[model samples]
Target chain A: MLTYPKTELNKVKRGTKRAVYDVEQINHILDAGFIGFIGCNYNGKTITLPMAYGRIDNKVYLHGSLKNRMLLALIAAKEASMTVMHLDGLVLARSGLHHSVNYRSATLFASVRKVEDPEEKKTALKCVVDHMIPDRWETLRPMNTKELNATLVLEMEIQSASAKIRDEGVVDEKSDLELPIWAGIVPLKQVAKLPVRDALLPKQLKTPKHVVTYYKKNKT
Target chain B: MLTYPKTELNKVKRGTKRAVYDVEQINHILDAGFIGFIGCNYNGKTITLPMAYGRIDNKVYLHGSLKNRMLLALIAAKEASMTVMHLDGLVLARSGLHHSVNYRSATLFASVRKVEDPEEKKTALKCVVDHMIPDRWETLRPMNTKELNATLVLEMEIQSASAKIRDEGVVDEKSDLELPIWAGIVPLKQVAKLPVRDALLPKQLKTPKHVVTYYKKNKT
Candidate 1:
């Protein structure tokens, strides 16, 4: 069911091979992340560019200036690939040699197309804004024609996607078991520190109820 | 300059044209990452793969198992393209519309070649391990011939590269500065927690100084 070369990947590169993949994991990582690394060949040159993104209905939407050339390379090509990853936690094994990461990430494979119509541009913008903050688009003022004209959009239908992960505790080689060292997962996580408010606002400024709501989410 | 079209990436897209790249940032990002992602079209089919790697003086050394078709594909063709990235921080905007990231990442352009001799393999391993843990090679046991036979090491010298960054704090976007909402960076970080001990017989295990040392190193 997995297309990645498991045996070849595992047998040769022991460090990267330890990563695991499953569909449920793919959704969770994407849902939680706001950035993706977009890679494409530009004018016969290769590039991996970082960008903020949103996913819906099995497709991903990305935007930039209309003048950007990578869009042309992608629009004219048969395929392009993008990846997003989160460094979950550091794996601290009994032996320092065996230490690894507990990471969550996804790669997307797709055929690309450009979105030229202004109506679609507006929709795409709202999709992204809403993805970052639920119900945000509904409250904000809509974009003007000038604002819409300045943006560029590309659609990548996720043709095939997969997630690679290492969330379990550390695995020790048989020879290292008796060594008197610590071993296991020392869970690493991205935590929201106490909110720092913009200084210009009065002391009464507060976090939105919805925004403050994430406190109960997995602190890990 | 920036290669990607501006309209495609959604809410998490750049807040300004500044987030796009010129040629220099692309090369820097490629030069800095610890590893990268590789995907290929195989006889009308495609595969996405991830591997641990190290960059030395602009040359990328990719080590894995001899069984990997990726290594075979690259070495036979004498060229390949891969994407590498390093995530810095997450941007949490006040209006969700303006939220972004503070990131420093790179992806390199390179070609693959086999590292055939024992000495060369040892040198490449040194770079890989040291890339993750500086001053680490001197502390460990060097690989034996049996271990070398079980591994595959491919070298890919970089040809070109690029970088893009999102480093600004929450952009109040002028017009929204008056909104009475908390706005600031949550400061995302990847940290190593305290290590957990092995399940077996050690009654008095303690973490080496590096356990706390490494965690202190991640200032992110």
Candidate 2:
């Protein structure tokens, strides 16, 4: 069982009991979501924005316009952290203080670099697209040189990471447990609805296999 | 409509066309989700974590244990930024460069302060719990003085904010429209499933009205 090195910077302090450093567990959390909150410092203020990302082994791929501010700031800092979370359920506890949401979250601290090599950049773009919907990139039009030049691709090598997950029923104090109060979990999920084909698409062109497969896999 | 005063801190740099500063729009985005990505600096490294929050007017409420690292850091800095995003769909385009997601995201810059007043602290905690599910606070067991004292609550007065929303369909190159490729949206939504009662719950106790209402409102 591989694990991320425990360091001062990446340690989870508040919920030590729920914190996990196992590499496989952290990767599972990352693979569950495509959008990640990337932390960046701008003019001495820390801000986080959700960005589309794809993870491969110890590397995470991100792409944006050449002038994207967050990407540029990360590139300048040479270090970054990304967090992904999936909300599983609402823990309705007997007491207000114990109310919490069941969730799986992972935070990765990494060394960042720009993917400037053409072949590597292309592969990274493909990874980003495929991360969103499996096998959809193969159906898309190939990228041209101009589009490639206009885009900026970044690769971050994971150095240390930690994941925290809470998936259980409500926990209430023994005294309060006997009280006449409702306590349970309300499960939540992100689902995909029916796909809407582009209006400009040819009437005869049915939805592709990859899109249908994605919908089937994601729909409840 | 009221708007947040735009400055370098809250300005949306990329995709400026989608930037929204209207206060109502930003609040609408915030109210749609309870979990927000809060960015904090620790030892010169910026890290983001997902935290449950409650919003009232220009103020956001968050509560955690006293030793929580992120909350403590935000208090030390006396300022913080939180971002909330709702992913609407995947915008699959014909070209790789045009791939995007339909989402509504808002970032808020705020001044942080501890809610030391006992009354205010109680309200903040109630707000945080009820924000997860409406009318939920009344159903929970009341908190004791000791419980109240153990919790740390922070009130962030929103100073500036901005939102970016992309709700439209795929935008592909004019030349690529003729290509025999699939381009469309797979609408995504976070929805609630039926409530799961705790195993310890008495069989005679039926699900509460508030819980049923929440499920009815959120279930697809």
Candidate 3:
């Protein structure tokens, strides 16, 4: 299996046992979520913001307004990093220290570049919209030239990445196992509720196949 | 209502209409979730990592192994920032540019200081635990001296903060109202499934009240 080469940058030092560098595993974690926390240095202070992203191969795409500060900082720095995480469950343990959360998280270190070509930018935009809802982009009104010019599309070529997954039940001290405290897992998930049709939508316009399919697959 | 004083560092530049500075609202956003994406400068590169946090009054607490790189970096810098976001839904619109996510997100910039007082550290730790599941810490086995010594707790005093909330339905263009496209919102939420007792637990031991309560309140 192909794996990202570990460097001092991407190494998971504290939890060595939970760290994973396999490219496929990392990609799996990335594909499971569309929102990522992107870190950038603003005036030498590190700040993070959540943004929707799309991944194709090793490239992750992010788009924002032309004056978006975080994206502008990334462009100025010529590098970026983003982290995506899915909270799976809560691990309740007999001991306070052992109480943890079950989660799958991945971090990518990448070089950032603007997608200036019109065709590539269009593809990236489609990738982002479709990433949130599969096959929905084609149904939307295409971007006009003014809208295209106002958006800034960035492509991040991942260099090294790491993922850490903790999917097990609680690990309390052996001595504390017999304690009367209750310990277990509470599985967590993001589920969809009933869809709300827009007020402006025509009464005759039924929800499309893609919308119905997404809801059916995601609803609890 | 008291509100956080916004500085250039914590200003919401792009989505001015959605910006919120009220302390109560920002705390509500923070209290809705325990996990936060903390940003820190590592070797001159910015990286974000997910960490469980606790808040009390105006201070936020984070604890990790003494060797955690991100925590250590925050200590060395003596300042930190973290972002917490709760995704609410997918806003499907008739145009690609209008596609967005309904979310409540907050960002905090703070000065970081290590909690050295044993009593304060214990309180902070309890706050962190109880934040995950209300009233959970009192039932767990208390931390031993060794465990306390091995953990590093950092207290972040909030300096400036801002929140952005988008809880509305789709806002499509007036011209696209007659289009055949389907536009609406697929509401999303994080929910809990049934609790699974630890395999090691005695068969006679029942799930505790706190766990049951949390599940009942969060489950779909």
Candidate 4:
């Protein structure tokens, strides 16, 4: 399907004008960032924490220690929801009420399941690592049996998702626009600095091309 | 108190070495960003959304439309938890198991209350704006009664909070350090770009000092 069939749960209620339901668009928002806020119920209170994730088609992968509380709770519940957001700019407005931020935000409701097969687990871990920095996972030393066994990998099948994007300049009251107050957008972005070699690295070992490429791509 | 007393709810479980309970350090993490991931129960599922927030002492101010579902849900529940995270870098390790990211993340649990007093509501709104761009709130046109009434302001009194900070280079197994693989840290940061003036702005008005200062501080 080109778009996700929105249920009451995934519908955007407040700013419907900015909402998007297209599967491709939602995926684009998800691919823009590797970190997402995954919500879990803890001690009768819902808490969200940032987690690194990898997406392959409609599936997202998350990994943590086998005893991680949030992952265990999500596995027990058999369902999860994750949200990813990118703050594009500050929408400085002429009036206090109109001040907003230009951002792209997507939330996904999914069916969560633990990956048991060793082969599938390996692929999932690679996906998660490559999602953060492309092409770097293959360069790392392979995971041994003990390391793989200690980690828990979860696969979330995206059931339904929606995204909201606001990428424009200020939207202020017409009357207030004529005021002498300055108004505009200050664009914001996440960037990478030069690579800092590990202190114990052999002096002859040079930085990898993949690391340099990532720096060049994300550097401001 | 110098530190928040750890409870079953706010204690860090997995990364004890990186966990921070000191109140000053938690506040520092909170002040580093203006957005937070707020978790709420919706349709029997917990969901998280990124929201802009302002902090003053122990209270966090969040403002949205009166009909916003998340805000209303928070008011009804009278409890809330918010998390803020800053991704510092990608820690590229020689081993897959040791690969991690350098970051500062904080989670806060608080009792939620709706701000009904007009003066307090105004103060809350101001706090949210100033938190985004210092000194810009007073420069904007004042909020009218209609705008104030349409907005819902919430005050969350932080009862407990914890921060985890991992800001270091790669840590690989001693056995893998001698391997010929490349390992290091690729530092990452969120930065501000040059401000774009509103399209309809009169050419005479220059960019405000507050915006300029913000850009100077945040720009790479």
The top-ranked prediction according to DockQ is 2
Which parts of model 1 have CA positions greater than 4 angstroms off? A1-23, A43-46, A91-99, A116-120, A133-141, A179-183, A199-204, A214-220, B1-33, B38-49, B77-84, B89-99, B135-141, B170-183
Question: Tens digit of lDDT per residue, candidate 2, span B73-159?
Answer: 999999999999999999999998888999999999999999998889989988888888999898888888999999999999999
Docking class of 3: high
For each candidate, the DockQ is: 0.30, 0.91, 0.90, 0.89
In the predicted model 3, the residue pairs found to clash are: none
Higher-DockQ candidate of 3 and 4 = 3
lDDT for B149 (candidate 3): 95
| DockQ for candidate 2, C-alpha atoms | 0.91
Off by over 4 Å in 3: none
Tens-digit lDDT track of model 3 for A17-123: 99999999999999888999999888889889999999999999999999998898899899999999999999999988998999999999999999998889999
Q: Global CA lDDT of candidate 2, please?
A: 0.93
Between candidates 2 and 4, the lDDT winner? 4
> Looking at candidate 3, what is the lDDT of residue B200?
91
Which lDDT tens digits does candidate 1 get at residues A140-181? 545667767777888888766656667777776778677655
Candidate 1 lDDT, B1-220, residue by residue in tens: 4342223321123334545445456556654545577655444333445566776766878776677776776687676667665555444554544556666654455666789898898888777766654555554444668768777888988655444566666765687677555566545545555555545637776555655565566523
Among all windows of 10 consecutive residues in model 2 chain A, the one with the lowest summed lDDT is: A6-15
DockQ of 4: 0.89
For model 4, the superposed segments whose C-alpha errors exceed 4 Å read none
Report the candidate with higher lDDT, 1 versus 2: 2
Error of 4 at A130 (Å): 0.3
